[model samples]
Each structure stands twice: as structure tokens, then as C-alpha cells.
Target: MSAIRFDDVWKEYGDHIVLERVTMEVEPRAFIALVGPSGCGKTTLLRMLLGEEQPSRGQILVDGKPLLAEPDADRGVVFQRYSVFPHLTVLQNVMLGREFRDAKFSARLFGAARRAAAADEAMKLLAEVGLAGQESKYPSALSGGMQQRLALAQAIMRGPKILLLDEPFGALDPGIRADIHVLMKRLWNETHLTVVMVTHDLSEAFGLATRVIALERSRNRPEERERYGATVSRDLEIFPRRRAELRSSVQPAPAGTTRSGKEHQPGRPGALVLKEQP
Candidate 1:
């Protein structure tokens, strides 16, 4: 389990401030969605959570441990673009992280048995992400949605404590994006993996998050910085725990299945069931 806490964090690139005095806490196994307009530091917050960037001021802690010096296995990240290697098969690409992180072998003599086990694990994750029977395919052969699924499977193959997604489904069609959302929700329920996703889509945020955080720019002038600072909105909305029926209602049925079990229903938009909570 991982609990994340950001205390008065400030992030800057040279002289440009990305995040200012941003503070929040993410409970263990909590699905937190960071939503905002462009250039509001949502991705920067994800980077800090992933330990890829350090805050210019204040601190962030994960599971009671500081984030700046944590190891890679503690956090898994999936970006909007496909991060798979074109040269390798899907199984091979998924196993790369485990092979480097845990294997003790020379490239000249990588053990067959070890690699096979790793492949099996990767295959299982691929199946979970709806990529079954595609393990032998190369990255170039898959659709954009399938590639993102592969990337996600690769990220979670090692079971990181925290999963960071930065607009991972942004490039996919609406139908595919909705399918990914269902997959993500199922994964979260099954594994209870703490997730922090940065998304520009308000509907996606509202659909997937246990709590949503909205970030905005400060409007305080320099003279009034201390006296009358502009307060950015940080609205938090927790959705009610979704039952299987609720999830099933919105879940896209298996490929080739139809409303009548014979003919497929084309252009059926996936429903997103979001039960709002305080």
C-alpha cells in the first residue's frame, strides 16, 4: 500500500513556475484524478509522484517515505504515447522491466527458463488488459488503443505500489477510450493498486476517480501575495463505491457479442456510470 502526501509543493522550470504551493494527500489504494486545463502542472505533479522530478520547494512523501530518492519499482508510469519498443514482441517488451530490475544474467546467456516465466507473467497482464492472443505481435501491428494497453500491462507487470497515468488514452477513439476506462476500473478493484492519473478530460476524471482535484492558476498580485493571495480551487469529489452491476452496465461487451447475440450493435457508445459523492 502507498499513501502519498504533498506538503506545500512548488515546481519550477528555470524561472517559470509549474505548480505553486500545491498540497494534497492520496490514501493507499485511492484512485485520484488530477484534472485541469493545459499548462496547469498536472503532468508535473505526476512526474513528482513518480520520482522523475523534484519539487523546488516543500516535499512529497509516499508510504511515509520521501519520493525524491525512491527506486523505480515503487512507481509505475504510463504516458499518453506508446512507450513500447518497436523491435520487440509484446511479450518481450513487457518483460524488459522485470528482466532489468530483477534478473542476474549476462546478455549473452540469459536463461531460457527465467525468460519464459517472465513472458508468462507478461502474457497474463496482457490478457487482463484485453490483449489476449496478441503477445506474439509487434508494437507496430497493434492499434493505438492496443498499444496503450500493452504499455499499461508492461508498467504493472512488476506490481508497483503506485500507478501514474498521464493522459494514457488521449489518442484513442472514444469507443476504445471507454473500454480502457472499464479495464482500468476493473484492474483497480481487483488489485487495489493506488492510482494517480493526470487527465484533461473532465468526463474521464469524473468517471474514473475516487477523488478529483482541480488545479488553477493563482491571480494574486506580487504586492498582495501575502495579504490577499488568490485561492485556486481544489475541489475534491469522491464517487460512491461501484457495484458489479453498475460496472457491468457500463462495460463494453466482449468483441463480436451483440445485443441479440447474433448481430453486432455498431457504434454503441459505452456508458460511464458515475455516482457522485460528497
Candidate 2:
């Protein structure tokens, strides 16, 4: 089943049309990069998927069900700006999401024991993002790259199934950006999350995404600009290794196959073979 489906979706604000007839199915565990010129509504599409805005026509489905009107823990988002709370330390920032969720349905606060466990998880998450020893530092104390890392950790702490990124690495230095790219891939591979990122950098899009989606307006003349909206102009699969891995994981394994995708030898318990004979 598709993790997300945008069905003939259209979005308009009074006389302004942002998206028209945008339809696509994003497979589960897919890393999708949405690229387009400035003001072409790439971020608008991301916002709609995040449930911050609704389509003027048609519908959007998540896991084959209509989306809720507002954002939920099932989705996490990071924007161009570092969104960490400046007043809170790194550890506190990451733990804040869980605290809110725990206190959401119940007014009671977590006891000392529960708080300690949550803190430990937050520490581990910060470590994963390469901010291990900076937990005690405030956002102001860190560099721009470190601040962004904190924002990522905060977004990921809730264990969202979908992660939305809007020009997340755009402001970083070239060297830092490359490092973050590697880290981003590691995070995606290690987690079960599907990612949708909007970036203006084509190189970044091509390097990080398993598939690249380009959005463009069909008519760009001054006379008919507002009358038309952007749609998917190009879809490209640029990651051969990732594509092969995804296909293998989703397809059913042959009978008597071992966990390594090799066949188990017949009449020999726990014996494995490279492949089954024809």
C-alpha cells in the first residue's frame, strides 16, 4: 500500500492557484525530493501533506485513509530555520516533544522515574544526530549546523512515520552540508520513516533522494500566470542501489529461503545455500 497518495489535488487561495491536478503515490520508506523554482509551490505541497493546509479540491490519503485536518505525531517537519527552542538546552529540547505527548491526554506530569527514562532516550537520540556531548548546551551556544542537528533530533524524538524537510541544509557550509547528507542517509536507512524534502539545490536533491520530483507551472507567461498552477513535471529514480534494496525488501521471499535471501538446503537442518537449483 502507498504510504501517501495525493489524488487530483488542487490548492487555491482566493485568486491565487498554487497547485493543480497534482496526483502522486509515495511508496512507504521512500525518500522523495521535491524540487522546483522559487514560488512554484513546492513548500506549499509539503505544507498540505503535513496537514497545515487543505486542498481546495480532491483529497489526500495517508495509509489509505483521509488525513486529519491538523498535524499529528505521525508526521515530523523541519524548516530552513533552526527551530529548536533557544531557551531550552539541547537535551531539554529533544525531550520536550515526548513530555507534551505524555501530558496531552492526561494533566498529570511524569514522576521522577519516568522522567529519567525519557531523558535517557533523548540522550541517545541526540547522540545519533552527532550532538552527544552538547546536551547541556543551549541552542545559542552551538553553531548553525549544531542547531540544525538539535532541531532534527527534536523532530525525530516522537518517532514519526513521515519526516518533512524544507530546505534543511541550504544554509550550511559546503563541507558541513556534505556531512549532513551522509548523516541524513544513515538516519533514513536506520529508521522506518518516509521522507519528503523540498530543496532548491538540484545537486542536493539528486544526491539525497531515492527519487526526484520536479514541480513546474505549465504556463509561465505574465498574462496567464495566476490562472495556471504547478504540477509534477519530472519524476526520476536516481538511486539504483536503494531502488534494488526496496524492491527486494517488499517482494515476497521464495519458500525455504534463509534470512540472508539465500535458499535453505533440503534435508539438511539449518543448512544454507547460495541459491536453489532450478
Candidate 3:
């Protein structure tokens, strides 16, 4: 069954349309990586899923229910920037989600015993994400990779069914990015959470995603700008492979073609091309 579904969704900004007639279904526990050139509405689509932006037309459904508002714990997002609280310790940052969920008046009123329990759980999560020994450090003190891990811990602590990532590894160095890729794969395996990631790197998308989606502008001319917007030009499922093997085995998706060396077919479940909005 589809964990998430988009039906003829359109997003516009006054005269400029961002997304048009995007339609797709994300199966439960699917790892999706959305890849496209800059300004292809990749991030816009992720933002809509996060409820940070609303579509101008059509519906976004989660578990068969329409999404009508801002993000809740059901969907957690991690951006390219390390989104940890600067002043708060790593433990506190990870505990914030639980505290907010359990708090009555305010999270600050959460008692010592409750806070301790939350901390214990947070510690386990920190350990899982390779941040166990550094929980006392502030965000500034941690390395870039460590901070991202902390961010991941914070998001995972919420136990979100769907995780949305917008270039979560974009700022890291190659070695660090690779390390994070492994960490992320391990986490995904353990949690079985459905993930949608926006990335510019096609190799990254191919290596990590069970599915790859590419968006592109329907029309490029200045006169046609207002008449067209980005749509899902290509959507294809990727078979699973070890990260080590993925890079060597998979060739980059050629322009106007998918990683599997096939042109997109809208009728196919594995490679779909969405129609433009009216």
C-alpha cells in the first residue's frame, strides 16, 4: 500500500508556477531520492510533504488521509544545515521532541524523573547515530558530521513514520558524506521508515534510494514560463545494492533518460512521467 500519495498536485507562486500536475505514490518503507537540476521544484515538493508549503491545486495524502496543515510528528525533516539548538546540549536537543509531546503547560515543566527517562532514551538514540560520547557537547563544539548525526538523532527521536531530508549531506566533505551514507543506510534498515530525500547528486540518489525521481521544467521560454512549471519528468525504482557496489555498478542517469538507461514511461510504476498542469 502507498504510505504517501500525490494526486495531480500543483504549486504556484502568483505568476510563477513551481510544481504542476505531479502525481506519484510512495510505498511504505520506500527510500526515495528526488534528483533534478536547480529550480526543478525538488525542494518545493519536499517542503510540501513537510507541510511547510501548500499545493495550489490537488491533494497530498498520507495513509489515505488528506494533508491540511503544517508538519507534525508524523513527518520529520532534516535540512542541509545542522538544525540543532545551539545553546542546548545534544541530549537536550534529542529530548526536545519527547518533552513537547509529553508536556502539559510547557516542556519546561517536565519533571526531573520524566526528563531523566527521556534522556536515557535519547542516549540510546545518540549511540545509534554515533553521537553517544558527545551528547554533552554543544552544537558548535561538534564537527560538521557529528552535528548532522545529532540532527538525525533529533529527528529519529520523534519516531516519525516518514522522514523528509533536503540535501542533508550537501555541506559535508566526501569522506564525511560517505560515512553519513552508511549511517543513514543502517538507520533505515533498522527503522523501516519511509524516507524522501532531495539531492542534487545523482550518484547519491542512485546509491541510497530504492526509488529515484527527477523533476524538470515543462517549458523554458520566458513567454512560456507562466504557462508551465516543473513536473516529474522521470520516476524509477532502483534495486538495492551495497554502497560499495552501487558506485561502481550504476552509471549516471543520462540526460532525458533514467539510471536504468530507459526513457520514462508514465504508465509504468517504475518509471513514470507526470503530466503538466492545465
Query: What are the TM-scores, per candidate, against the unseen true structure?
Result: 0.79, 0.85, 0.85
| lDDT (tens digit, per residue) of candidate 3 on 66-136 | 98579888888898885889989998899888888888468753578877888889999999898878888
Evaluate model 2: give its lDDT: 0.81
Q: Which pairs of residues collide in model 2? A: none
Give all candidates' CA lDDT scores: 0.72, 0.81, 0.81
When sorted by lDDT, best at the front, the candidate numbers are 2, 3, 1
lDDT of 2 by residue, 40-157 (tens): 9999999998899999999998867998889988999888885888888999899988888888776334699888999999998888899999999899999888888888889888
Off by over 4 Å in 3: 109-112, 240-267, 271-278
Model 3 TM: 0.85
lDDT tens digits, residue span 1-278, model 1: 46677888887777566678776656556678888777677887888787778888889987556785544887888898857889989988888888777755743226888777777778778888999899899999999999998988887886787889999988889999999999888877666367889898889988988778887777546654333321235656453643222234234433322212222123321112212223
Q: How accurate locally is residue 237 in candidate 1, as Cα lDDT from 0 to 100?
A: 48
* Number of clashes recorded per candidate: 0, 0, 0
